[model samples]
Target: MQNLTPQTILKEKFGYDNFRTGQLDVIEKVLAHKHALAIMPTGGGKSITYQLPAMLFDGITLVISPLISLMKDQVDGLDAMGIDATFLNSTLSGQVQAQRMSDLRSGYYKMLYVSPERLEISSFFDFIQQLPIELVAIDEAHVMSQWGHDFRPSYLNILPLLAKIPGNPAVLGLTATATDRVRQNLQQLLGVADEDTILTGFARDNLALKIAHNVDKRQYVQEYLRENKDQSGIIYAATRKQVDELYEFLNKKGVKAGHYHAGLPERERQAMQEAFLFDEVQVMVATNAFGMGINKPNVRFVIHYSVPGNIEAYYQEIGRAGRDGLPAEAVLLYAPQDIHLQEFFVQKSEGTEEHKQNEYNKIREMNAFANTQSCLPRYLLGYFGEIVDHDCGHCSNCLDSREMVDVTTDSQRVLANVVRMNQSFGKAMVAKVLKGSQDATVKKYDYLMKLPTYGLMKDRTLKDLSSFIDYLTADGYLRIEGGEFPVLKVTEIGARVLKGQLVVEKRVNRRVIAQQKVTSAAKGLKLSESDNKLFAELKSKRLELAREAGIPPFLIFSDKTLMNMAILRPQTDEEFLAISGVGEKKFDIYHKEFADVIVKQH
Candidate 1:
């Protein structure tokens, strides 16, 4: 362990009793000048892993990180605690960046974060060598692997460049997601000794996971938001296009909403982010880009619009919620197509077959969570090597009805239909045949010949069948050979199920009601009758207030302000603040007129 006191520094600055799980050990190792790898889950106090020790240790701790947003967020948080911290990144103007770097060199800061690409710049490297480099913290060190979720080609080149620095700073690698393979890769890449590496098994006990299967996912999401309107939350879409579309839809439905995605222009993305941070917007519909390093303590829920590629991605995404640890929700609106799509995404990742196989194992882990009869959190923790007691009584599968069925025959029938139908049928078509929907397409294809199978599954809607198919795909029993139209191919599991050799137990789908719009039922006062009442009230008040404030009415309040005041009919100063155009300055100036009119109205 590193010498000196984390307690003293933690108490003085952060006002905390102690560090959370896995923080103190990593901090100690770093201060001792030993190379270390810290693999803790998101919201697991990962920043404190390096940051606390940076304050206690000798010399400037140069922290390498991704995400300019996260850097600014952390720096701002540090600044709030009366710590002197600054970051150097693309967001800073060159002139500003140079001055900040000069300050860092001249003993102005104990910790500084620069991007990996910044490390390779020869001038930056030379200047760093001249400075007193005590420790180096690599944030999101898993990006070193192209196989890792957030691969950065630049990060792959950082290790050799760090070696060129006059003295290698004690290396501390930090990430929220890493298994044995990821941890091993991290150690080898950072050149850390095995004994120096620290692992806090991933376990988020606060989050309550729920799976809404075979339901209209969009409708389910709408209801969850409507029911939990008092609390702010995030709904993560899988694509930028989905983010934009959902944002527009929520705005039309009258939710105070904004979106964050890399696809937007930088200005728009930042504005949306700032809006959410400032609480100017109630809900932020976003892609994965939005949650990388956000530290909003009051996020009440996180809804995934789609399943993530693997458990690591799932854990990291849901970990964004309930950071204040107040029993927040992590809901997955899963269906059959979702797994196929995820598998297709995995198959498309840029890696060798060996690398693809590695991703396959990760995906299999995620699927196990989705299809498991055990507790969701328990399963999740076990995947990360943590021991969890019995069912959490919080996950969807945990609270769900457990009427397990012998679905071997059902699975085999679906598999045969896909095989018999030329192996190129779309999900809807496969589902329609199974449900005996007898849609024109199903009748056109003579799917009746395969009747005994999917035909009996008809009472269960295609949505239900689709959910089952998703599980089958995730488990590798059914392959979605991605092409123009992804065709389902039977795997060895599917073939075994056909022969009544494999038994698969699944929970029947749940019925869900779509959310109704939670908008104000009353229409606004009409502009026609509204304008006369507004004008008369404003003119009368202006005359009376003119006698009091002894100023002309126009200077006291603008016409727009008067119009809004009349429309809202605010009964008090607090209510007056609710008027659209009445900021503090205008309210103070024109208080008497508005107050008198409001008082007289009753």
Candidate 2:
């Protein structure tokens, strides 16, 4: 408890002589009891904001988190730092929970992670009141707002409970995403006084954000999975079904994907997260719940399967990568339908009518960006009111798009085909008619008799046509004539353009590359001369260790483990565990062998 200063903690435990950009300043203010709301970027050391003080303080620090897997991951990280940490939740049985409550009373843990609702229990409150509570940290505090992408009703109860605490514990609310509105809400509702809010602007210059098109996103991700091959990563999707589908697809494609979402059973979620942390699962397909407090420092890529709701949401999701200060890729695959995905959440919001109205307005603002003619990165940065120093030149809008051509003639043919088909056709069927493809609908229209622009538009793919149609809707050139999935109706603008009265263009459409065929660790890893020797030795030792532990060989170590062994050449048991893939099971078995090999100098 004596080393509360960020300086001492960083030097002593973490062996770091200095703090990164805003770390020292934020930690200093936090220790000085500033009720701070920090908007640090992803890869920023957000955890250290609370952790330094938690280590320096007298009583147990309680971290209120949204996800249980996050709790365990952070606990594991803190434990690695040699700090006492534990997580309490429904995952703990009544007996185990009772025992942990006793441990908390005995001050056995320096920090504890508990769900917001679990802490709301009267008995839990009584126990909490008994403890020497030092700090109350809220990870992902933006979620309390009804407008936040990952809102939780349980988070609302924290305000009242913090009020009742005998000691109004110094509060630290950390999130990677927060608008001026959400930030203001956290300040007022969470007792974070206006002056106390630390607005460390969200800007990570280290990350190269790119949006790629034409490649199948699944295939694109597969290529990323193959090329980066051994690096740690997470792929985010908007839906649980996407999470499940992407998880299976990635696995089928050969990436060891750990599918994680709130819908999974607690045990299953924990097991999958543990596998990821242990490096048994090289990639995770998850909703946002899989991140928040999970601290894996060397993650090299964060792929978004759909457009995240806003820049704040986008920054937080992508922030999970490049945390280790290495070059990392943040690939976002945004199809035209993605804007609707977040829009769905906006329309489904539950709160005061005023709150819902505010959320709806934000959703509309977000839509404007989705349909903007400016740089995509600039549009994202502009949302947070930050001016981009230069056009990033890395986003899809910059790389994938060409100048939109006057597709008036193309639109005429598309519209004519739709009109000829009684306006009953989807965009795909209509597109085929323009390309002169004699498919079911094109033949049904056998209206090849009227192949307007047929074969003239063969260069355009369905995706290209979709993008044109999408922008037409956004640009007020055309409207979906019906409800969701409506047939297109050329608008007054479209008619004007068709008649050559007006001229316009939009960004050319692009497609996401699906990940390439999944290649396995054994398939892609060609061990160098030294690496092959190290792998053989590591594998032999691992097999022996697994037999002794009576577990599967892979249960002891993975290909990633052997790979790390070849790269790091650790000289001690302590150092061996510090390598990314070496977990408890492996360390227990192959530590001496790996260390002996590292020291062998062969």
- Candidate 1 residue lDDT tens string, 270-369: 8888888888888889878887888887888888887776888888888888888788888887655666776687677776676666666565556556
lDDT of every model, 2 decimals: 0.75, 0.72
**TM-score between model 2 and native:** 0.66
Q: 1-602, model 2: which lDDT tens digit per residue?
A: 55245787888877788887777766776777667788777767888888878888877788888876567667877898898989888767899988887888888888989889888789888877787877888988888987676678889977888866666678888888887778888888877777677777766656777765444778788888899888999899989999999888887777888999989998898889889878998998998777776777788889988777666667787888887787777887767677677757756755666665555455445444555555666766767767777776666566654546455665665555555656676556666665667667566656553654555466557766666555555556665543333465667777777677776755442211101111222235455788778777778877887888898888766877677667556655555656656677857855776678766745
Tell me the deviation in Å of residue 326 in model 1.
1.4
Number of the predicted model whose lDDT against the real structure is largest: 1
TM-score against native, each model = 0.72, 0.66
- What is the alpha-carbon lDDT for the whole of candidate 2? 0.72
In order of listing, the candidates' clash counts read: 2, 24
User: Lowest-lDDT window of 10 residues in candidate 1?
Assistant: 512-521
